[model samples]
Target: MKITTLIENLKNDSQDLINESGLSLYIELDNKRILFDTGKTGSFITNAQKLGIHLEHVDAVVLSHGHHDHGGGLLPFFKVNSKAKVYMKRKAAGDYYFHILGFNKNIGIDKKVFEEYSNRIAYIDRFTEIMNEIYIITDIEEQDLTPRGNKYLFAKEGNKRVQDKFEHELMMVIKQQDGICVFTGCSHKGTPNMIRAARTIFPSLDIKAVIGGFHLMTIPMLKSFSASQEEIQAIAQMIVDENIQKVYTGHCTGVKAYKNLKHILGSKIEYIRTGSQIYV
Candidate 1:
C-alpha cells in the first residue's frame, strides 16, 4: 500500500504545496487508487496535480465523516472524476453543526452539493466491503475510555441541538501484509472506538498503524476548555496497550496533544503533514 498526503495542516518546508486545516489522503493499494478525504478546498486538487496524481482515474472516494474540512473538496472532485464512486454514511446528508461561543455553524457536507452527484454515491448504513481487503467500518463500539469532546457538536432534530451521535462518522481499514492500517477523519467518536470497531471486523489482524486526526487536540479559542490531561494520557496509554506500532496524526490533533502523545509513544508517533507518504 502507498499513501500520499494530498493535503494537510502542515507542509514540508521544502515543498511548495498549500496547507490548510483539513485532511486528504491519496492511497494506492492492490493496483487500485482511492481518494480518502478531499480536504477543505481546491488546494488538494492543486497539490495532487503537482504530485502528478490524476483524479479522473481514482476508483473510489471514501469520506470518514460529514465535516466540511474533510468533504469540502467534493465540488472540485466531481468536476474531475466522473467514474469514482463516493462512499459515505447515509446520515452524512443530515444537518450537522459546530457549536462554539454561543454560535452554531453548519459544519456538515452540503446537501445541495451531494444532490448533484447523488447517482454516483453509495450511501451505506452498516459495515460493508468496498473491494478486496478494503472495508468501510461503522457502528463503532468503544472499548476504552475515550474522552467525549463532542459537547459542541450537534445534529438538528426538530429545533433542538441534539448532541451529535456521530452516526455519519465512518472509518476505512486496509488489510496489509503486516496488519491493518486504519484511516479516520476527525475521529469524533474517538480513535480507540474506531480501533475497537476495526478489531471486530478483522479480529485476527494487529492494528499496525492509525493515520488521521484523533480530535484530542486543544481548542485555540478555549485553551482551558479541552480534553483533560488525564484523558489525553489515557488515550496515549491505550495506543501502547493495543500494541499499535505507529500513529500518524495531524489537522485537529493539536500541538499540545501531540506533545503528550510523543512523551509516551516517542518516535512511534509521527506527525503527518502535506507531502507525507507512507508505504506498507
Candidate 2:
C-alpha cells in the first residue's frame, strides 16, 4: 500500500498554497485508487497536475469533514471524475456551525453535491468495510470522547457544537506481511478513540504507522498554544500515551506543537511538513 499527498501546505516542485488547511491525499490500496478529502481550493488539482496525477482515474473519494478546507474542491472534482464512487458519514449532510472569535459561520453542505451519484454513494453512519479489509470509521459516538464544542468550535442555531463524527474521516488498515498501517486525515474524533475503534474492528491486527494531519493548532486543544515550556512538556506526555509507531503529521498541527510531540514521541515521530512525503 502506498499513499501520496496530492494536496497539503507542503507542495512538490510546484508552487501553491503552502500554509493552507486543505489537504488532498491519494491512497493506493488493493489495486484501487482512493482519493481522500479534496483540499480547500483547487490546489489539489494543480499539485496533482504538476506531479502527474490523473484525477479522472481516481476510483473513489472520501470526505474527512464538512469544513471548507476539506470540501471546497469536491465540486470541481465532479466536473472531471463524474463516475467515481463517493463515501462519507451520514451526519456529513447535517447543518454545521462554527463560532469564530468575532463571528458565527454556517459551514453546512448540500447533499446533492456528493449524493448526485446516488448509485455510487455509500453513507456509513457508524462503520463500513469499503473493501475486503478496508474500513471507514464514521463519526464516533460523542458519549465518551472530549466535547468538540469549545471556545473555538462553531455551531448553528446559536452555534452549538457540530458533531462531525469524524464524519468525513476514515481509518484505513493496509495489511502488510507483519502488520497494518493506519492513515487518517485528522483525528478530530480523538486519537485514542480512533485507536480503540481500529482495535475493535480487527482485534488481531497491529498498526505499524500513522500518517496525515493532526489538527493540534489551538492552545485549548494543544495544552500550550502560548504558554511556557513547562506546560508544553505536559502536552508531550499526553501524546506519548498513544504508543503509535510513527507520527507523520502536518497542516493544522503547528510547528511548536509538532516539536513538542517530537520530543515526546522521539524517533517514533516521523514529521511531514509542507512539501515532504513519507513512504511506507
Top TM-score prediction, candidate number: 1
lDDT agreement with native, every candidate: 0.85, 0.62
TM value for model 1: 0.94
Per-residue CA lDDT of model 2 for 156-238, tens digit only, reads: 43455653344445555556665666666666655555556666676776667766665555532333354234434543443
- Model 1 misplaced stretches (Cα beyond 4 Å): 218-225
TM per candidate: 0.94, 0.80
Candidate 1 lDDT, 93-198, residue by residue in tens: 7888878788878888877667788988899788889988898998887666554567778898888889898889899999888899999898888777787788
Minimal lDDT window, size 10, model 1:
217-226
The TM-score measured for candidate 2 stands at: 0.80
Candidate 2 residue runs with Cα over 4 Å from true position: 12-19, 110-120, 139-151, 157-170, 219-243
